[model samples]
Every structure is written in structure tokens, then in C-alpha cells.
Target: MWAVSAKRESPPVPEPLAPLIDAHTHLDACGAETAADVTAIVDRAAAVGVQAVVTIADDLDAARWAARAADWDPRVYAAVALHPTRADALDDAAKAELEVLAARPRVVAVGETGMDMYWPGKLADCADPAVQREAFAWHIDLAKRVGKPLMIHNRDADDEVLDVLAAEGAPESVIFHCFSSDAAMARTCAANGWMVSLSGTVSFRNAHALREAAAVVPAELLLVETDAPFLTPHPFRGAPNESYCLPYTVRALADLLDRPAAELAEITTTNALRTYGIG
Candidate 1:
């Protein structure tokens, strides 16, 4: 199952590694609409040793659906937050409801929040730096109040993201989801004891700097995710992604760090469980 067509189907499942967890994914964006769809997605992932996943919400509707999906499948956990690009939507009512969602038992973290300077000027509706920062700070506080890890979504605003955390005081547990920065940033995150979750983009041949960053990440602080329905790993880049494809990134990461695949699997799975407060 390691090889797959470039068509719209799920990328072929790679060889099963030791049990692993996808710390982030978008089940809804992957076209899952019901409990059965969630089962099918998780089942495919389980077949490849990705025994669990944290499906993240990027908006209100997705937040509701993510909580429901977590109930629908034991392997599914949820992290709810409005994306930084959509920070302007976090009005009073949204915040109230999001707080309730953030308190759910199966909701693992407050996340996919932080900065996205990549879109502000390029997209007219994208949240500017100030709006995104405000929303990020709010989510940070929410994570602290909820006593869960803060999951971050940083895009082309590394220094700004770090600056905001320093200014507002970060939560005890912080994770940089889809870490795309360089070795320096990786060292900084490691030094601060923040978790660094890498995605499929690390497998791209041209991602030399990302590979270097991966190499420097301490095993304990290292986590892995698919960020599926996007950032499919190399050889499968541009193909539709799903949780089952996570092993490809795990193997790629193992190669990048020159560790055994199973060892990397154990390290990342252990880190994921602790970071998300899951078993």
C-alpha cells in the first residue's frame, strides 16, 4: 500500500510502523461527514499503525463537528480554535461558545491559533497582525484557563509569534504545529521547552532548512502530524492526504534524523500522548 496514484484517492498507506498518533488533521476537510466517515478514516489510519489522531477545528462549524467526531470514534480527539487568518470572527459570542467547546472532555488543546502574516496583505479579509495577535493571546489564555496545551499555527511570522508569547506569557505547555522554520527557530523552541510538531512538508527535497531544523529537535520535544488534506509528503506531494499517510512523514523524519523508524515512532507517539494529555 505504500504506492498510490496521483488521483483524488487517499495516498497509499505506508508500511505500518510502531503505533503512532497524528497530532493534527482536518477530518471535515478530508470529506468526512458522519460517524461512518470518521470510522472509515480512522480505520484506514489504524491499518498503518496510526492508532489515534487529533482532528483540529478551523472555525465554529468545524469545532462543533470535531467534538462530534471525537464522540463518534474513540481514536479521534479534537482541538478547537479559529484559525489566525479568521481571527476577526472571534467576537464576544464566538468566544463564549469557543470557551465551552474548549472545556470539553475529549477536546485536547486550544489551538491552530497564532499568527499568519502570510495572508494579511495578500488576502483582503485576512486578519492583520494586531487582530491575529489579540486572538492568539486570547487562545493562550483559554489554554491556560482550561489547563491544556496551547497549539500554535504560525505562518511567515516566526519572530512576531515568539514576541507575542514572550509579551503575554506562554502556557506551561506550548506546541508549534506544522513547524516550518529553520534550525535557529527550532533551537529557540527547544530551548524554551516548547513542542515542535513537524508535517509532510519536511519530506520535500527542497526543504533543506526544514530538514536541518528537524535534525536539531530533541527527541522528547519532537512530534509529528499529517496536516492532512494538505502538505502531502514528497513522492506523494500534490496528492490528497489523510491520516493514513502519516507514516510517510514519520519515516521521512526518521531518515532526516537518522534514527530507526520504530524508534522515532515510539518517541513521537509518547510525546503526542503527553502533549495532548491523552493516553
Candidate 2:
């Protein structure tokens, strides 16, 4: 569940930079319900140099839509999995369906599934921690079998997530989508060869730890995303987000790392292409 407030106008699109890829986003949540909407969204992103986007599925219908969306647009790819909060919904039927979706050529990853300790106790419908852990292992195995990266969504359960990854024998590739950890965790991720995908949150004024984490992340293990319809970058924190807004965060990271924005864009785009096994 997202804590959405009064709607603010979307931020002005930033100037185009070197070609980039949005390593994670949610097109369906960004109000893309049809092929035209998908094209328009990708077009907006492309105008700002976001050449490709990997939309993520948080539930069954979303999974179906994401897989289909990837086929609908040349610039779109997808990741399929139930969000950890919805781990309870991963019934046998859902598992079978997800496995099939995971194997789809356009579905680039098995993800948005790790742990969400922040909600299990606060939200009645949130899956139990045990259930979430079980589903996480299942998704990891599915990713392994599908031979795609395992995209993780961790919230307030860093240690638990790492424990599960160790026990489950992590897939060939792992991405900490929307990585919200500290420099220590960033170092750990780099040491273990796990990719860390930073979202717009890094540009927030109060995300000092996240910024520090970003600075320490090895370029080879770094990626970028929008996590659209949420976590809009600073100066537009309350506004709706879309893949097109990724440049703001990219520019912010460039300033933080004191590198040229185009260089960072190239680095992230190359990492994303390799991580998703797509062009």
C-alpha cells in the first residue's frame, strides 16, 4: 500500500542526457492501461534519454499486464513476481502462472520479491514474515530456473533479506531494487556481487545514508530506476512519478559523485542492459 497524498503536478522533464535505462518502474501504476498509454509513457521517457524501461509486476493481473506490455512496446521489458506484501497471494496457481510468465522472453527478471518487515505487523493483509520468506525462496529458485536476474524489494529487513539470500543460494544475478540501505550494506552488496538499483529516493534531501551508500557502490554493481507512481525525486516529492523523471535522480547522483551526468548515464545503462540481459 502506498501512502499517497494530495496530488501535485508532475515535475518538469529534465534536459536529455546520454542514453539511459530505467532499471525498474511500474507502468500500470503510472496509469498506463493500453498500448497507446505505454507508447506515450515510453516516448516521454525517450525524449529525456531514458531509452528503455523495465516495468515490474506486483500481483497476478499486474504480472499479466507487465508481460504483455513488454510485447506492446519495443522500449519496454518486464519483471514478474508478487510484491512481498502480497506474498500470501502466491498460491499454487499463482506460482504456476508466475513461473510461466517468468519464462517469457520479454519478462527480464523475477522480482520485486524479497522482504517487507515494515508492513507485516502494521498491515493486517500483509503476509506473515514466514510466508514472505518462503515465497522469497520460491521466487529466487524460479529466477534461477528461468535464468534471469532476481530483483529484490527489501524494506526494513536488510539482515533478514541477506540471511534468506544466503540460505537459498542466491540466483546467478540479484538486484536490490530501490536500495534503501546504508554504506555498510552497499559495501556488502558489492562484496557479494549483488547489483544495487537506486531509485529517486536517493535525491531526497534527508536520504543522507542512501546517498552515502550510492557513493560507495561500485559502478559495475550500480543501476538506476524510477519506481514510478511513487518516490518522485526531490523538488517534486509529492508529485506522481514516471519513467521520464529518472533524469532528475541521475543528475543528482552525478552531482553527489562529482562526475559528469552523461558518464553516469552511460555506466548505468550498460549495467542495466547486462543485468536484464537485454539491449
Candidate 3:
């Protein structure tokens, strides 16, 4: 099992909402390391009407785990890719293996991949911006080849992400998972037929910009996630987020976007199924 803090406590249950899908998450990072752990987590998520979750892989080991988790539970699907922060490690061997995993059954998408400038030089193991760009291009190609949606992760590199997608031509379906950019960029995504997936960050009191971004995104182009074990929604911001806490984020989006929670839930679920082609 991955090392985790002893004090890591899961979030309390919230009232169930209409069924929805968590477009992006990391089951391993959330401390669910075994088949039973996976089932328990999914069970918790089910309690809150989170019918399905697309757990993402940030590295090869995690990719392997993600693929297994998908097989272990029908509600789980995998999106495998070398995260931009770790893009420097994608050598020939890594690429070959990732290509094989990307095509695995239940490995429905190629991503949690894109440009991130927040970590390089600042954190150990973080890839340089140039390396990240190169990997992003490759991942875009892999997504296209696999005939799956490209789930992107952008952090402090919004313009660059769009540029890469435009230059190489984005996949048939592109999802900006955990979209945290401004209204202008959100509009740009909508115009280009890309998806804008909101996370708990949109509900943060200081995240007014994200709220505005959500406001401008057309309903059909919208999605939601916890980006769990990280961006827990308000009132539970500092807690260990599981898919069970997703209701908070969904409710926040419904209120911010001026739609009823149930209605928004059905819409987002439909979009998720359509976006990822999940059964």
C-alpha cells in the first residue's frame, strides 16, 4: 500500500443527489489500494448517487493499478497517461508500456495529461515546461489513435494547452478535466467543442474566477468531478475527499450555474456517458 498519513480521515456522508459521474480522480492517491478498498470507496460514492467514476493514472504503476481497479469494479473506468508534472520520465520503455495499457478494456480515455507549469523547478520530480509540452503532444496523438477522449490537466498553462491542442488538432472529444481558467478561456473551449469539467475548486469562496468560468460554459459542454484527495468542496475543503463527497461539488455547481441540482446531475451524467462512451 502507498504510504499515507495516519490522520487521513474520509469525509462524512452528504445527502444523495441525482446520479452523476466523477470525470476525473485518482483511486490510489485516495488511499484505496486494494480490491476491497476500491469497492468500499465506490460503495460510499454510490451512497451519494455517484454512479460511476473515471479514475486516472499519472504514471505506469498507477496506470497498472487503475486498469485493475476498472476490472475489479464495473463503476470504475480508467484513464491512463503520464501526467505533465512527471512527463520527463516518459522514455521509450514507458511509452511502449503506456501504449499497451491505453488500449486495455475499461481503460476508456487517454489522460490527466496536458501542460502544468506549477511544479517544475519548484518541486522534486516535476518535469520542465518543455518536456511537458512534448509529452502533451504525444498523449494527444495516443488519445486519437485509441479513439477516446483526451482528458486534459492544465495548471498555470491555459494558453499553452489550447495552443498544443490546436496545433496538433485535438482528439474527437477533449475534456478539460478540472477546468479552472477564466471566462474567456471557458468560452474558447465551448467554441472549439471541448468539454469543461468543474471540480471542487469552483466552490471555493476565493475562486470567483472559476465560478464565472462555470457561468459562461454552456450546459452541454459542462462536467463535474472532485479531483479527490485534493480539491474537496466548501465546508469540507480540508477533508480527505472521496467520490462520496461529490454531492457537495455538484450542489455548488447547480447553485452557481442557476440550475436545480437534480436537473444538473442528470445533464452531467448524460454528458459523462456520452463523453467517455461508458456503458
Compare the candidates by TM-score and give the number of the best one.
2
TM-score, candidate number 1: 0.96
lDDT of 2 by residue, 1-279 (tens): 774445577889899886899999999999999999999999999999999999999999999999999999999999999999999999999999999999999999998899999998799899999999999999999999999999999999999999999999999899999999999999999999999999889998899999999999999998999999889888888789899899999999999999999999999999999999998
**Which 10-residue window in model 1 sums to the lowest lDDT?**
1-10
**Model 2: which residue pairs collide?**
none
In model 1, which regions exceed 4 Å deviation? 1-9
Candidate order by decreasing TM-score: 2, 1, 3
- The prediction achieving the highest lDDT against the true structure is 2
TM-score of each: 0.96, 0.98, 0.96
Better of 1 and 2 by TM-score: 2
Q: Candidate 1 — which pairs collide? A: none
lDDT of 1 by residue, 1-279 (tens): 123235755667688886899999999988899999999999999999998999999888899899889999899999999999999999999999999999999999998899997887788888888999999999999999999999999888999999999999999999999999999999999999999999999999999999999999999999999987889998878888999999899889888778899999999999999888898
